[model samples]
Target: MTSADRSSDLSRAGRLRLAVAQLNPVLGDVTGNLELARRARAEAAGQGADLVLFSELFLSGYPPEDLVLKPAFVAACREALDTLAGETADGGPGVLVGLPWREGDKLHNAVALLDAGRVVGVRFKVDLPNYGEFDEKRVFQPGPLPGPLGFRGLRLGVPVCEDSWNDEVCECLAETGAEILLVPNGSPFHAGKPEVRLQVMVQRVVETDLPLVYCNQVGGQDELVFDGASFALQADRSLAFQMGEFCEEIAVSDWRRDGETWICESGPRVALPDTDSARWQACVLGFRDYVEKNRFPGVVLGLSGGIDSAVVAAMAVDALGAERVHCVMLPYRYTSDESLADAQGCVDALGLRYDIVSIAPAVEGFTECLGPLFAGTHAGVTEENLQSRARGTILMAISNKFGAMVATTGNKSEMSVGYATLYGDMNGGFNPIKDLYKTQVYRLAAWRNANRPEALKGPDGIVIPENIITKVPTAELRENQTDQDSLPEYDVLDDILECLVENEMSVGEIEARGHDRELIHRIEHLLYIAEYKRRQSAPGVKITRKNFGRDRRYPITNRFRDRS
Candidate 1:
């Protein structure tokens, strides 16, 4: 067919079947991801889908990181895209898959439209996001304002992920004769991010008078979890469809042309869970994918009677089955009877294997060896850290023996203030609650007890005892030691940290929020000093806007205190 003939055919559309594939692709797994796209295309063809839409970077996986810099990796991705394009010769559904494309000296985050055994057209992502968890500018060259790609009888405006966040890309497409807007995203979940996304899409819909289909990637990747709550908005700014969150799905939507605009017919609209439930599910999915994708046998964590460890243990069981999770109590001299009872209670409730390993033997050995060297030095934080080191050593030994990943159980509150012991409690493969504040941890534990998600592999009921959640949190390093002895109360500390970390509020701004200036300064100092510890900490689920790893970056040796 000639170009003019194809353009005329695209203008007259009756019913178009679009299969939105919300899939999870492993980072740097180009060939494997291509196979995933192939399978989804086959399934969509079986359902008579005219087109299959995969999430951003479905071929090379989202955020390929420095791997995209390697020429061989980019070549592999290009090869994979070509192979998938060849499969369209069978008259199957045309595929729109995201991959890294190289032209001249610049590499672009490009989406390819495949049909009839060839790449029909390609649209580069214009908006290269550089803020928050994105560093797209480091590797990817931004494409110019993109117009729509012509697919079989349709002028489809394809916005790659961040392109649809603002008005420019969609507006440019609408002016270029685009009929429908199909946005593919790799948007990671951070608390109420879905609501933020919906608002952004509605604005574009209202601006362009074009129906928008938002498709996001699903599953977890390292610290990032892509909640695939993909949806569609009609030209009238009404929601047409809503997909489920935190799971992989392929939903088919039927679109019809009405005069000069396209409208999505009514389809499935799955209600999203509340904030607490969503956060819990994000942690579960993130942890599960890390364990399974890394091919670990299971996970082992030091389960103290504290709320942090207890909640982590429950999440591990939910992510991996009970049989795959192992909990151990590394008790020291300060370990309380209440703690032992509570730890055992959690293990029993979750139906996971539990063991108690006393750290006294190792703790005493270390103290005795250092006694003479220390001379008359007083036993203080140094001595207290010995217990934590002993417990970390024991957990590592267990992990080495059984090939299970060790899960560190420090919440964001402790991490923010440098309260956690590095190479001690921080020695683990991953942390499920590393991004959550101590206060949020309590709320999630309570929510999990009251409601069990169908995706959970663990048993229902109160796995976390009320005592664990209700009791005062302690490290049990010394006699009757509480966290507040060294840090502020969790409620206050978390709020202050959130201001400093997430909001980037100045000392004056935070103080104006009813916080004492001195307290803010102290927390800010600790937060900066703790950068080194957070740098070494295991990657965890990112449940907040500013996680320690990617979202917030600070130097450890910096002396700049937020005195102002």
Candidate 2:
């Protein structure tokens, strides 16, 4: 008997060798990606895999963004698919891969099942998730459910990524003689998202009574990263083969038939950290991938000694050693001694290279230049933004000179409302804290300081000064510029943003939840007005359900208000 027949666990019912290849594909690199896919397939075949599944858009790339509009790019993707299909004819292993398929005028976000060097079957995505970071509907057309492909007398159904989320695809396949369901996904990572996936997959398995293999893509793409964390759910809703999260791995598991149905027996359970811990690790990974993949030498950012920048600096140090992280303290005329001391404390604690670049010179230059324009205007937040702009310009200059990318440190709370300066404090190549709310920032800071994870390379023991966290948050634009002076408390602000952004609750709905009406309105106005700033903002780890980029797209020129 094979290993599958000998296994007694319900999780291992059908013994079929399967391989999941977690890959990172560069956008628009058709040739490179196809070759990478072939290499992965060859590797899987070497491991004795009967079938290998790849992540979504593996032939092209996830979130090809506007490149899907290019006709030539689509044609190149199709040609690459043809090459992959031709390879399977070598009598190697069957392959399930994501690609953009063109059928006359309709282009589909599809997965092709290849066997014996020929295209055997194709499954199309049914559910087009447009909300949040997905714009699938805006690009490719949804495809019809594909029936099972008969191979070696075993009928297999392939649900291309989003199709597996709903029961229709799996149900249709099961009804059409599909004994097993294989899902190829390019699902992105968010805080607590994998659990949701697990719940959904388990439910699908229970409903279909068929063993399922959940294969996902890995690595950062633009502002998003797909955490592989691929897993297999047996017919009895038990986890069989669990792959590692937030990393690359070529995992192989055997599935076998038990009684009348097939199931995957336990091979290994890849333990995942807690939700918050995973978010922290994902943030670090996102930063590393964005910097290294883009070929940036290092990173630089303003060290305000606040939780936001402090946490970002810590992540940067963890991502690219302390040697690669450059911290700058841009103090202005109104900057307090405590802030300065706190900034220094973080620098000293982390042992990173830092410099105190006073913004007085540039601030004075800008004030003198705009002297006539602001001659009669009362100097208020405009002056504070001037200080921020000065600091931003200085950091950008240093970045340009030293060939290091700037890491912006704005959290979701600041980005929710128009609290951040557009081209000023918002300047950076990446923002590690963009998805984290202010509360989350503080919590993560404390968590990192107290218990350092393996991903964190910085020194321990309060890398973010206590004074920075305890002190009232202030931009220090003017003499006494507290964040509360311009916005609501973080506790209140994050709640409103979550209701508005994630839950899609309107202003009235949020106000009904016991928040002040005027406060909600003000926050709403700030969020709507800040689209332009977010558009130009740096890419960051997407930990929340709805991040500023990709997830939420508001018109910068719209006049519509959420009065309801």
Candidate 3:
């Protein structure tokens, strides 16, 4: 008989049912998360799956950060995994899961292959990524490439997430005559990361000629969100079965031998969303999940009716329902009637719950408090910041009373420099549009208003009003306080930010790109000084190649300047 026929004989006893469990687990919630795993297993078994595989780090959640440093947390993970292992002993399907494993004095990021209520084998992660957004080396100790483990005469090779990124794991498994390669990942999202996965998988498939299945985790975890886009490739490096991105799904596909090779039976080949659209959707999902999963009742934000807040509010309503989103107009003495009416019109259009909370009293309260020191000083940007802070405090009070998360509406442009107020306008639990630049914010708002995707939870029709779109941007902190009063225009500002933050171009290089040297120096100065504020800022969706939280890690107290 051919190798294909021989491989087929191994699984010909009955249909080998397989299921993928995409879960949204909270960090450090071991008990609750294991229960979620149990429920998912039962559902998969009920659907006739012979083996159910959950995403990586489903036990205690991914990037547990300093929580992993706690011995008690690792102990809790062991207990949770053991409890789940025991549950599978009653003749249910096998389970493959990821968790933190403490072996003596070392902590390993491991995956357990369980069958008949016992963990038959364990594979520790071999590759620990230390670059951008990951600090695995700080927590996990790497292990050697894992060999195959036998189950009912079938040798299975399981790689924990990053293990498959290197060929050592796959070569060892193939050398050991492993029947299949299953990789469980806690991979976070970045534009076009899924395609990179496909490319890597295809290379492995051509080398080992083994049918590979890649399953990744999903949902927002603080600043990171794992888009669970699971897929399988045939031994011939051809796409076999694929799951949708940014969603949770359990799909079963048959694998049979074809003359010394394995091929997945007919299944879905889902197309991943484009970068721009995917980014928009990720922001919306992150916003929605962070609010709902954290048990926050709703969201509140200042509505200057500017493009940033307008887009953020629309995104908030789209994330949480219209009834759950709250818009407050914290108008100051300089606030124009046009802006007031525009804010109201936008809220009304979106069917959101809005209130007019004038910040005059609070602003005066601060002014009175600081009057002694400011007896004869001329009013300036400091006073403007105080006004912004007053509005921020009022929003926080409302949030405190109502148990709602304040969704700060600052865009990438404002966040790039020191345009945002630290304790004032930046007082929020999450920022939906944090990764998007000012120009992209306008484009997305227009796209969302025109084509309201059913997946979006906001009210249908134009959520962001036209007047808000066309109006000049302003903080409304002082009389005639247009954003241009303090910074460059949106188009120019976004380009500069893209260069300084994303491209990491020196001030001289940025100026060489046609921006004025004085402007570049001023922006660079602002950006460096604002590190302290950004350090204490709330976590938000990361939809760019270089998000502030994870991708960029500059010292808050640095005194270096790159002149060239």
- Candidate maximizing TM-score: 1
Angstrom error of the Cα, residue 55, model 2: value is: 1.0
Q: Is candidate 1 or candidate 2 better by TM-score?
A: 1
Candidate 1, TM-score vs. the true structure? Answer: 0.97
Residue lDDT tens for model 2, 1-564: 332332232233245778889778877889999889888888988987877888888888897766878899989998998888898766667788888877889878888778766787787777777767888899888777668866555778888777888899899889898888888888999988789999999888888888888888888887897888888888778887888888788888877776668766545588987877788888988898899888999999999877788888888988889999999999887788988888888888888899998899898998899999888899887887888888889999999999999999999999878788978999988988898999999888777777766656777677777877788998878777788987888999999999988898988889888999988888888888888888888888888887877777778987777876
Mind giving the per-residue lDDT tens digits that candidate 3 earns over 1-564? Answer: 433443354466534557778677888889989998888889888876667778888898987877888998989998998888888776666788889998888889988877766787888888898988988999999987778876544667787877788788898899888877888888888778889999998888777878888988888887787888888888778888889888877776666656556567766688877776777778888888888778898898888877888888888877778888888988888888998888888888888888998888888888899999999999988888888898889989999998888889888888878788889999989998888889888888777776766577777778888878877888877777688988888898888888988888888888878999888888888888888888888888888778997999998998887666
- Order the candidate numbers by TM-score, best to worst: 1, 3, 2
Q: What value of lDDT does candidate 1 attain over all alpha carbons?
A: 0.91
Query: What order do candidates take by lDDT, descending?
Result: 1, 2, 3
How much is 393 displaced in model 1, in angstroms?
0.8
Candidate with the greatest lDDT versus the true structure: 1
TM-score of each candidate structure, all chains considered together: 0.97, 0.91, 0.94
User: lDDT of candidate 2 vs native?
Assistant: 0.83
The backbone clash count of each candidate, in order, is: 1, 15, 3
Better of 1 and 3 by TM-score: 1
Candidate 2 clash total?
15
The list of candidate 3 runs beyond 4 A from truth reads: 1-15, 507-513
Runs in model 2 deviating more than 4 A are 1-14, 85-91, 455-462, 506-512, 557-564
CA lDDT scores, all candidates in order: 0.91, 0.83, 0.82
lDDT comparison, 2 vs 3, better candidate: 2
